[model samples]
Target: MLLSSAKLALQDAIEASPLPDDPELQRNLSEYFPAPMRQAYKKQIDNHRLRRDIIATDLANRIVNRLGLIHPYELAEEESVGLAEVASAFVAAERLFDVREIWEELDEAAMPEATRLILFDRAASAMRIQMADVLRISNGFRMPSDVVDELGRGVQKLSTGTEKLLADESLVLTTRLQREFASAGAPEKLAAKVTHLFDLDGAVGLADLAKRTEIDPRKLTNAFTILGQDLGLAWAQGTAALMSPSDVWERLLVAGLARDFQQMRLEFLQRLTRRKGMKDNPCETVNAWLDENAGAIRQFRSMITRARAHTPVAPAMLAQIASQARNVLSR
Candidate 1:
C-alpha cells in the first residue's frame, strides 16, 4: 500500500509540473553561451520526453548495424551492456546528437578509457558516412550501393586512377631531366637539375630537401596551375607584372619552402630585395635572396652543430637532452 501511494504521488507531481515557457531567458542566456551549449539546450528542450536509456538503446542498435551485425540476435547480452554504458556516457556528455562535436572531442590529448574509445569510434564512423554523402552529392556520382559497397569502391577507383596518371608523368619528367642535365655537365643531384632548368644556380643545395623522388608530380602541377591563375588575375587587374612559365616555376619552387622555413625565408627575401635593388622579376629575386642569406644559413648550421654535441653525462640527463633535441629537430 505504501509503495502504491508513493507511485501515485510521483505521477501527480509530474502531471502538475509543466515545462517553463521562458523564451526570453533562453534568448538572453544564449547570447553569452558557446555554440555547443546552445545546441545542447535546444536538443534537451525538443526531446525532454526521451529518456537516457532509450537513447542508449537506439545508439547501440545503430552501432551494431554499422558494424554489419544485421540480426539482433547476433548482439550478445554482455556486449549490449557495454554498448549501453558507452552510449549512456556519450549522452551524458551532451554529444549524443551532435556528430561533429563528438568527432572533435575524440581528438582530445588525454587517452580515453575503453568505453569512451568505443563511443569515439562510433562517432568517427558516423562522421565518415556524413562526409561520403556530401562528396557523392557534390561530385554527382551515382552508384548502386552493392556495387560501390560500404568502402566506396567507385570513389577509391577514381582516386587511384588519377594518382597513377600523375606518377607516370613524374617518371617521364625524371627521364627527360636525367638526359638533358647529363648532357650539360650538371651535378648528378636531382635538385641541381631542376633548379638549373630555370637558371637558378644558388638554391640548388636547399632544393635538395625537396627530393624529386619524394614530391608528388600532382602537387608540383597544382602549384604551377595556381601561379598561372594568379598571374592571369593580376594581368586583368593591371597590378602585378607578367612572368614567363620558367620564371614562375622557379618562384613556385622557392615559395614551397616557405612552409618549412617561413620566417627565415621572408627575412631573407626582404633583405635580398633591399640589397639587390631588383623589382618585378622572381628568378632574380630568389637568386639574390639565396646569395644574401649565407650568414643566416651558417647560423642555422651552428645550431645543428650544438645540438649534435652530446657530452658524456648521467644517463637520465643525457636521455632528456636527446629527447628535447629530437623534438626541436623534428619541428
Candidate 2:
C-alpha cells in the first residue's frame, strides 16, 4: 500500500477500542519456539516502528524546509501561511517523494540529461497540482492578496516545460539577493525592502526603502537594476560553464525561437494600434486579424512548444529565465 494509505490505516488501528484480529500477527508469533522467541519478535517490531517514525519525521522536516526555501518572502511575513500545514498537505498527497526527488536533483552539481528531464517534468506537474491548496492555505492566513497572486505566478512558471531552467535561475537570484543585502549592512531589512519593491508590486516606494536602508534612492535603483542584469549574465555564463557547446547552441536556438514568437505577437499588436483609427469597429478589426492569423499563430506556438520539449536546459541557465520573468512582472 502507498505510504499515505498505510499511515491512515495505522491511525485507524490506533484509535480502535478493540484492535482488529490479525492472523498474520498470530502466525508470526506461532513460528517462535518459546516466550523468549516471542519477545524477540516484539523487539523487532519495536525497532521497525522506531525506524518508521524517524523516516516520517525527517520527511516532514524536509518538506517544511523546501517550502520555506522556495517562498522565503511569503513565509517570512508576520501573517503568512503555516509551513507545517503546507507540509502536511504534501504528506497527505503522498508527494513527499516528489519533493525529495526535486531536492536531490537540485543539490547535484550535474545530472544525467534523461534523468534531469524526467525529474523536472514529474516535479513540475506535482507542484502545479499542489499550488492551489497552498494558495488556499495562504488565503486562510490572510496573506496580502497581491502577495498570494505573485506566489501563484511564480509557482506557475516553475511548473512549465522550462522548470529546470527556472529553478536554477531562482536559486541564483536568491543567493545573490542574500549576498547583496548582507553587504548593505542590514540584510533582513534590505531584503524586505527589495522584496516589497519587486515581489510585492512596489507596495513600498524607492524613497521609503532608501530611507529605511539609509541608502540614497538613486543608488538603490542602480543597485536593483544592475543586480537584475548581473543575474542574466551570471546565468548565461553558468550555463556555458556547465554544458557542451552543442548543448549551449541548442538552448540558444530555443531561446531565439521563443523570442521571435514574442516579437511576432508584438508586431501584430502594433499593427492593430496603427489601424485602430481607420477601423469603424476596433473589436471587429481585432477579431478579423486574429481569425486571419490563427493558423500562423498556432503553428508558431506549436514549434516553440516542440523546441522547448526537445531542448534540455542546463541547471545553471535557470537564473536568467527567472530574472527575465521578474523583470516582466515588475514592468
Candidate 3:
C-alpha cells in the first residue's frame, strides 16, 4: 500500500509538475504518506532534477498510449512502450504544430527540442509496431499467437534495466534507428550490418557513448526507458482462443514481465547472492542470492530468444537477449 501510494504520488508529481516540499507536501500527505516515504521522496528530489526532467516524458507517454491497436500491417511507430517506432518520430512535430490539440494551450516554449524529439520517435514507433515484422512473415496471419507459434524461437530477451550512460545512449541511438528502419520495413532494419550513428559494439557504457556522441548520460537514461519498453515485446496475459488479444497478453505476458521486472528490481539482493563482493564464495550469501534471484532467473531466462534479427551481441548481452527465446518455449 505504501509503495502504491508512493508510486501514485510520484506519478502525480510528474503530471502536475510540482516540486513537493518535503515539510509541507509531506505534512499534507501525512495521512496518506508515511514519514519514511516523505524522507525518501525528498532525498530523491534533492538528489536529481527528476521533476524538471520528467516534464517531457510524462507527456510523451500520454500521447503514445492514446494511439493503440492499429492494424498489424501498418507498422506505425509508437513511443518506447507502444508498438510503433517510425511514426513516433513524427508525432513530436505533429504535437508541436497542434499544440492546442491535446493540452489546454501552449506557448512556443512547450515544443522544446527534447519534447519534439520524444513525440516524433513515439509517432514513428506507432508505424513500426503496425508492421509487426514477425507477425507479417506469415501469410493470412490472423492472430498474435501466430507469432508465438513460429519464430517465437527468434525472439530475443531484453536485458535488465542497466544504469550505464554509454549503454543508455547507444540504446537511444539504436531505438531511433529501430523506429526508422521499422518504417523502412526492410529485413536489414533490425538486423546487423546496417550503418547507424551508434553501433551496438561502438561503446559499452554511458560515459563512452556520451563522450563520443555528445549525448548526456542523464538525457540518455530517459530515452533508454522509452526504448526498452518499445523494443521489448508486449506479451501480456493469455486469452483462451475464446479470449481476446488483450486477455491472452495479460494472462501470459504480464506475469512473466512482472516476474522478471521484480527479479532485477532487487538488484542489491541479486548482487549479494552471487557473492560478487566477497573474497570467496560465502555459501550463505550464495544461498541467499539463489533463494532470491532464482525465480527471476527462471522466469527471465525462459523468455529470451537468444537472437534478434541482424543484431548480434557479445556473450553477456547475448545471454541477456536470450530470454525472449525461452518465453516462447514455456508459453
Candidate 4:
C-alpha cells in the first residue's frame, strides 16, 4: 500500500479500535504499516485518551535527542527536572501539546511502566546535555555577557534553574592564577604566599606582598609580570589592580640583574673549584679569587640594593657561596 494510504488506515484503526499495549503489537504495526504511517497513527491518537501518553513519551524522546542529550546518568536531580521542564515548554510552544497532562497521566499511574521509563531516561539525558554545553562554552572562564545572552536565546535556552551552572568569574580567575604561578616556577612557599594574598578581600598589590613575605619588592614585581604576561596583562591587572607603571621597569631591571648575577656566580664557582686542585694553600687561592671578583660582586650588590629599598644587599645564594668559600679556606 502507498505510505499515505497506510497512514490513513492506521489512523482509522487507532480511532475506531483500541490497540493492545504490547511491544510485539507495536513492532507488527511498524512492519505492516510502514514508517510514515507510524506518525500518522501518533497524530490520530494525539487527541485519543487511550494512546496520548505513548505519543507524549515518544515526543519527549525526540525533543531530548534534538537537544543533544545522550547521557542520562550523568545529570543531577535538579538538572534532570529542569531539562524536563524545558522539554515540556518546547513541546507546549512547538507542538501545541500539553505536557501537564502527560505528567498527570504518569502521576495517576495510568502511563505504562515501559513508557514511564522512556520518559525518565530521555529527560535525564537532556539535562546532562544542557549542563555540558554550558560548561563547554564557558571554558572554565567567565563567559562573555554577549555569549551568555546569545546562549539564552539559542535552542537550549538558559532557564532560571540552569543559569547557576555557569562558571563563577572569581573562581575561574583564581584557578587560572594558580596555574600560571605553577607554570612560572614559583616555589611552593612563594606560590602559596602569593595565592593567599589573592584570597584576601581586596585587590592583590605587589608591594604589599613584598612587605608581608619579606621578599625583594623587585623580585615580587618580576614574578607578577611573568604571570601577567602568561595569562594576559589585562586579566592579571584586573585581578591585581594595584600594579603600577613602575612595575614594568622593575621587571626588566630585575630580570637583567638576575641573569648577570647567575652568570657571574657560575663563573666564580667554576674558577674556585679549578683553582682548588691547582693550589696547595686553599686559603691563598680563595683570597686571590675573592680579590679578583670583589669589584664585580660589589657592583652587583649595589645595583640590587638600589633597585629595591631594604632588600638584602646580596641574594642568599651569594651569601651562601661566600660562607662555603670561607669554610673551605678554614679547612
Candidate 5:
C-alpha cells in the first residue's frame, strides 16, 4: 500500500509539472526540450523527491517508535535507513514493549481490527502495512492466556477489597469521634476530622487525602482553628440565629444519611437484578423499580426531610464551612 501510494504521489507531481511556455514549440521538438525547460522539469522533480524522502523518513521513525524498535530520542543516533529497515525495526520494537506499553499503544490506536485503517490515515500505506504485520507477530508473543486471566482476577480481588472497605461502618465511627473531639474542646481536630470525613466520602478516596493532608498538617490545623474562631465569632454576633442544640443533632443526622443512602442504593441494585427478567434495566424501568422499593425509599426520604426540618441554621452553617474551606485552600 505504501509503495503504491508513493508511486501515485510521484505520478501526481509529474503530471502537475509545467510544460514548456509554448505547447506547440514543445510538440515541434517532439520529446526533445530546451536546456532551461529541462532544468525546470528536473528542479520540480527533485523538489517532489525531496518531499517524499522527508515524509518517508518521518513515517519510518514513527513506525519504529510505535513498535518499540527504538526510543524516539535514540532516533537521532540510530536512524532507519529505508522502508525495509523501518519494517524490521518495527518488528523488534513491538517485542521490546510488548508486556505493557506496546499493548497500551495498540489499544489506544484501536488495534488488531481497526489498527490498519487508523495507521493508514496517519502515515503512508506501506508503513501501515508493515505496522499491521508487526502487530500480528507481537500478538503471538503475548503473555499466556492463564497468566492474563490471573492478572484480571487479581484486579477483581483488589476492587472487591475496596468495596468491602466502603461498606464498613467507619463513617459512623469517625462521626462519633468528631463529636468527642468537639466535646473535649479540640475544635481544630474536630473540624479537621469533619473535613477528613467528608473528603473520605468523596470519589478522591483516603489515599489522596493522606498524601495531601500530611504535607501541611500544621497549615490544616491552623485553618480549622481559624474556622473554629470564625464560628465562635458568628455565634457571638448572632447566637440566636446560628446556635441551637437541634442544629448539632441535625448535622449528626445528615452525616448518618450517607450510610443510609449507600444501603438504599445497594438494595435497589439487588431488587433490580431480581426483576431484570420481567423488566428492562433502569434506563427504561426506573419508575417501576422505584415503585417496587417505594416503602424503603419513602423511609429514607422521610429521614432526610426530618433532618432538614431540624437543621435550623442552614445558610449560616454553610457559610462557616465555606469560610473554613477557603482558609484551608489559601494555606
Candidate 6:
C-alpha cells in the first residue's frame, strides 16, 4: 500500500530525474532498468528512485527524531546489511522486552499462548540470525545498502534489498551451530540456546535447558539482555512482512488497527485484553470490547480506505480479525 505521504514523494521524484529533459538519457534509464521496474516510464523510474532515496533518509530522520538511536530505527550499519535480518531483529528484540515486562507485572498467563509462542519463537530466531550474522561479518562479509533515504526531496520505495527471504529458508542454522557450539564462545553459547528454543518451538523451559546445556542460569535468565531486548521484538514484528504470502496482508492490516484504536469499544477491549480475566472465551467479552471501540474501528477503516480509488477486500483470514474487532465494538 502506498502511504499518503509517499504519493507526493513519487510525483516529486519524477520531476527531479535527468531523463525528463533528455529523451536519450530516458532511453538509457529504461534499458538499464531492473525487471521489477521495467514497466514504469523511464523518466518516472529515475525520478522515483532518486526521490525514494531521499524519502528513505527522511524515514531515518523521523525515527531518529522520535526514538533516538534505537535498533530498527537506527542508521544502517555493517551489521544491518541484511535488511530482513534487521527487520526481525528489531521487532523480535522489542517483543522479548515487552513480554518480559508483562511477565513481571502479571505472568506468562497474561498472554495468549499463540501470542507468546510466536513472540518467543521470534526472539529465538532473531538471536540466531544476529549471532550468525556477527560471525558472518567477523569472518569477512558485508551487508547490502538501503534502497534510499527519506521522502519528498526524494521518494521512499521498498525492496528486499538484494536478498530474498525464502519460505523454505535454507538458513544453515544446523550446520553453523554444530560448528559454533563446540566452542566456549559466548555467541555460540547463546546460539545453542537459540537453536533449542527455536527448535523446540516454545517447549523448552528457559531454566531446564540452562542446566542441561551447562550454561549459567542467570546468563540464561533473560535472552533479551544476552542479545538485544527491543531489537529482537522489532525484528520479529517487522518480519510480519515476510510471513507466507497467505498470512501477511491481513496481519499487517490488523496491526495497522491495533496501533490506532481509540473508541470506547476498542478502549474497553484493549483494557480487557490487558486485564486478568482475559480468557479464550472472550468472544462475548470481545463483542463488548468492540462496542467500546467502534470509533477506533472506524478510524482503522478510514486509514485503509482513505486514499483508495476503490473499496478493497481481500477475502482473507485477516478479515476475521477485523470482523472480530467490529464484533467487539458492536456489542
- Report clashes for each candidate as comma-separated counts: 0, 3, 78, 0, 6, 56
Backbone clashes in model 4, listed as residue pairs: none
TM-score list, all predictions: 0.18, 0.23, 0.24, 0.19, 0.19, 0.21
Q: What is the C-alpha lDDT profile of model 2 across 169-243, one tens digit per residue?
A: 435544664565445443353233332211211112222333333443333333333332322332332333234
Candidate 1 structure quality by residue, lDDT tens digits, 146-166: 212322322222223332322
Residue-level lDDT of model 6, residues 156-225, one tens digit each, is 0101110121111213433444454434232343334334333321111222233333433333322212
lDDT tens digits by residue: candidate 3, 1-331: 6434433433443334332321222222332335676566765544445443343243334333333333211232111122222222223222222222422221122444554344444433322322322222323222323333322221211112232423343445556655764454433422222322123221112222233334343443333333233223211101010122245334333323322331231222223333453223333443444455456555553443333332432233333443542332232
Give residue 181's lDDT in candidate 1 (0 to 100): 44
Q: What TM-score does model 3 achieve against the real structure?
A: 0.24
Q: List the residue pairs that clash in candidate 5.
A: 2-125, 2-126, 67-93, 67-94, 68-93, 69-93
The parts of candidate 5 lying over 4 Å away from their true place are: 1-260, 277-280, 293-300, 312-331
Model 2, which residues run further than 4 Å from truth?
1-56, 64-79, 89-99, 108-133, 137-331
lDDT tens readout by residue for model 4, 1-331: 3433433433343333222232222332343435776676765533345453443344344444333342322221223333333332233222111223333343444334564454444333323333333333333322123232333232222121221221233345556656765565444443443343233211112222333344443333333332222222222223222222245444333322322322232233334445543223433444465466666545544533343353332333333333433343232
Tell me how far candidate 5 lies from the true structure as C-alpha RMSD in angstroms: 27.8
lDDT of 3 at 121: 42
Candidates in descending TM-score order: 3, 2, 6, 5, 4, 1
Q: Which portions of model 3 miss their true places by more than 4 Å?
A: 1-245, 248-252, 255-259, 265-331
Candidate 1 wrongly placed segments (more than 4 Å): 1-268, 271-279, 292-296, 308-331
